[model samples]
Target: MTATNLLPRNRRPADGPSPGSARTKRRRRPGLMLTLGLTGLGLLVVLAVVAPWIWGDRAEELGPSVHLGSSGEHWLGTDALGRDIFARTMVATRLTLELSALATLIASTVGITLGTLIWVSGPRIRAVGLRVIDVMISYPAVILALAIAAILDPGPKACVIAIGAAGSPSFARLTANLAASVAGRDFVGSARLLGVGPLRLMRRHILPNIAEPLLVLLSVSYAHTLMALSGLSFLGLGVQLPDYDWGQLLAGGLQSLYTNPVEAVGPAVAIVLAGLSASFVGDGLAAAANRSRRADAPAKATKPAEANAAAAVGTAPAVPDDAVLVVDDLRVLRKDGTALVDGVSFHIGAAEIVGVVGESGSGKSLTAMAAARLLPGGLHATARTAELRHPDSAALDLVAPGAENAETRRRLAVEIGIVYQDPSASFNPALKLGGQLTETLRVHLKASRREAREQAIEQLDFVRLTDPASRLRQYPHELSGGMRQRAMIAAALLTRPRLIIADEPTTALDVTVQAEVLRLLRAANERDGTAMLFISHDIAVVGDLCDRVLVMYAGRLVEELTAEDVREGRARHPYTQALLAATPRLDTAAAAPAESAGGPEASAGEPASAEPVRTLAAIPGRPPQPDERPPGCAFAPRCPQVLAACHDTPPPVHSPAPGLSVLCHLEQAGARTGETGTDKPLEAAR
Candidate 1:
């Protein structure tokens, strides 16, 4: 039931179908419900826009002088004023709807913009802005409107501004909070590393993801604003008596409610209906957006198609003699000065794929980010010198302190791209995918709008996205998970960078899509000679994609080996061996049958076979905390191969072969004993 039991007995590598072909077969096209809902919303918009013109002068005309009840000549009857109830009601409804709708639009626009800006601004600015908004929202909206209307003139515009101003703070606070939350997501970090500036990042990535909540806020706020406007109008501080505003109608009808109750009820019903319709539309849009976002959640199950994709692109490119990316003694320390990555060194040559593998918090990703000078907040990289080969100059040292000039950073961003774990969260919800992709091309390549657009489409095509031209018009929310990831990669590749850093690129995708992406990356390396540094926690993935594998443990390099070495069970480090042993094999049959008599297996020893009821072994205890690291060796406490010397002196790096290295006291002592080639530490190799 444990992970080890999932491995195949023989463990032969799997050969499955290509991810692109599998996606082609299984991709769910957009359903008709969304299309129909959008159409209905569009019609409602038209109705709201032209309702005044349709009802026209009839609103002022007196009906056939008939009283209440529905009839041919005076449908829904005449009011106490003998006005055409149907016509007047329509006109009043239009006016009320327009004013409230306009006010709502203004409020939402102002609120969301302010909120997003506040969220993007520093903590001090946001604190002040939020306090100011809190003070504004404390007052009752109707009182605010009345106070403003009493001072300024009584008019619809005055009512709208006052009501909108009152509602603005709420929406602003909501938007700012939403934007701030999304701004910290992995996708945003990825976009930043891609060299997307703040403005473009907001427009393309942050805004779109927050649209659903914003729409919901707008809808609810519109209803509240409408009610406030009506209340003001009823109090004679709104659109004035002469106009056919619904609130005024209700106010006038209230005087005659004893004799003609229908007068007040008719306008009242219209107000309720308008509010209902708007609420429905908002709810529907919000529901649709929620579903769309959920649909893009990362895949949890791996598929055969992914295996095939890996197989198809499994071949490694010839490693160039000159290093394209070089990292020397790179160290990343936390804000508290505790090392997360310490003294790690590696290099990727032209057209090479170097995979960094480790358990969680092994610092593989930190190392990759450090190579591109894109460390996360609160983490500082020191003792580093990452050199990147530039087409115009010799190898440029990217990790050298204070080397990040604007022009230099920009050049690196354009020439060296990164693909992140979560692609959907990386994009701006407000902008179309095409626009996002094109902006990268325009900024980095200096392509004209038309040329950039063309390049965007071309990049989409390269990622194997179907209907590349039409797809460009779609936003990130419209695309599937795999499609969104592909779009992100396309955007990265548009600049035609010489090197790429892909951090868990397949983690959020279905196995099929993962395979397709892996294939695409391999092809990029082989066909375009784009050197890459790929980081993952999955050893199998590293084995499938990388040319060379670097194993890291507790912030230091533990072992370096070839992909073939890993596959052939030649890994030397105990951690590396444990990782290989822990990987789940797709070909293995489940020990706990699909349905169990007792229950599902949640622990080690659930019967799988008659082979003495083997129980899966788990690595017990947590990794060492950064600050509490042991003096002699950070990992020695947990390492099963501990020795007396290990507690006193830290291990030094020992090279057993030209390209292989390990940092362990055991390996060091073995080297000293002149048994370098034959010595194998602790567990069986791999």
Candidate 2:
């Protein structure tokens, strides 16, 4: 997708700014330093354009008295050649700024282009490029420029080239590192998996995300370039004789320093002022960028009554069909044909919350991404059927041949929203929260600026975000983790899509914020009947919020049970039982031994050796890797109740109770006879 799809256009309405827009600008006003820096830069540019024309004649005219000190007639005295020192300094502004500006442009263009190319290239090329940058930067920029200047004829053109080439290595190194960091972010990966072209991805996502740091670096480079050019001119290798700069003026004044001290002071002061101007501008831009990184403070903590009031909902809106999403025999395979997610099948009904629970690397998120056709590059997904049904369109088979075209992807985007695990990485750091949130409305619904803003505010308020309108002016980094997640929820629900694939959405949040997010999600589902494919590793969280839970281990589903079944100790799989046992309990008093009910006095009579020592339960061993999985059940090695037959044979899926499926040898064996195996009792822990 193009940036215009998410960013606001510059079109002005005949009716003027919308009510929301009229109240506040898209972003807050620039800080005092930024304003001052901009003002100084503007003034310098004006002087560069007009100074030579206004003072050229006077600067060339010989004064009656040579080597004159500061006086009423001569503010900065006269040089040895009887030229006006102040006029000469003023006249040199154009040439000085011209050389530096051109040099900066060359450095930025070459450096940024090389750095971006390095980031996008293969590992070998990137390694070579990084080494090249290091080698170039090892030489001091001024020394390198001096060598280049000595090789070329002394002139302005040569000076610009030398300085520009000397400055490029630093820019290149910084750009490469910045681009690499941004390219691996979740948002960038999402855009790529969604079929955004490489060029568009770089332009719309990577560049914008990295622009702030590049801008600050550019300003600093310009200042350095100006200094380098001035030094070259002072050494008689730049600007030549006729075309003078501050450096040449200083050169001439230094010859008669004792007699005409003010002459050198004039040029020296001008150079210092110019350098200060660039420094101020760079500092200002850096401060602004830092503010973007440290976004607005989080909203006040949510009160219990307020949370309850916000979560309250009436009857849920009726959905068009029962099942919002359905997948059968789903598999996500790497290019080498190793299955990351193998044979995962499930369905989500209207307004139902289906949680996929697993340990790390168990393919919980892979399955969800496969269902949405958002698997990363180098990985392809296939299934017998992967169908998505939205109220706005007919059913779409995401895994069907030629189903990944622009139109199909657009439809998929409109129908499904994804809430990624890291809220910070889910957004474009350069864009405001409002623009990113309202992008769906503007692109999919063709909403007007005013309409989108109003609806965005409403959604933000619904998610319990305080100062909803003000938040529209803030950037992503300005908010706290909880606030950003809430905004992310608002962004997802803005279009009211049929399904929201929340991939571990609450993993980064603290307990209090996690609870609030769960409430908000539950409320959204209840009010809109939106189906959710909630993916998380936290069994307690899944058990609390989900209607049905699918437990996965080592790229395969091991068990399926209802929320009540998970809570009431009815899980049939050994892996699921182990996960339950590993969960820590909060109520120590309740879990305390019955013998200790009379406290220390009652326990005093008992032998100290008879006292029970409690320890937190933990599962032994780790889940198997995808490619290195055992021949039979993937979890067989980790299963505590592993049998000899289980080592050589894959377990068959068996339904011992209504709506419960277990992939276990015991379950399969139980189905052969009248006996049904008993599941270990589990405590209901939140």
Relative to the true structure, how large is the alpha-carbon lDDT of every model? 0.69, 0.77
Point to the candidate with the largest TM-score: 2
lDDT of 2 at 491: 81
Against the true structure, what is each candidate's TM-score?
0.69, 0.69
- 1-686 per-residue lDDT for model 2 (tens digits): 11111232233334456657943453234356567767877888898888878988999998678999999988998887788889889889888988899999999999988888886786688889999999999999999999999999999988999999899998899887777667757677556544566667778888887788889988888888988999999999998987799999988888888766777898888888788778777887786664233222322332122111111111122223578887877778765567777777778898899999989998898898788777654568887767887666678988886666777766676678788899888888777877777766776578998899999999999999999999999988888888899998988888888898899998897666777788888899998889999988778778888999999987887788898887664677877877776655443334367555877677777765562433345666788656666667767676656667777666767776766788888765652222112222221111
Q: How many residue pairs clash in each candidate?
A: 6, 3
**Count of clashes in candidate 1:** 6
Q: What tens-digit string does per-residue lDDT give for candidate 1 at 1-686?
A: 22222322232355555767865444323224334435654554666566669866766766457445456866656776566676776677667877888888888889888887776676688779988778877887677777877777878878888888778888887776666667667667656755766676777777877777787777767767877888888987778666757788788778767776666777788677656655665665565453333222322332222111111111122334677877767777665556667777777877889998887877878888777777755567765456787657767676666665666756776878778888776576666777767765666567899999888888888888899999988877788777888887887788888888898888887565777788788877886888888888778888777899998877778788898887665776656766665665544435345334344444335456422212223444556654555666666666555667766566666676878876677775653322212223322322
**Which 10 residues in a row give candidate 2 its minimum summed lDDT?**
306-315
Error of 2 at 34 (Å): 9.7
- Candidate 2 lDDT: 0.77
Best by lDDT: 2
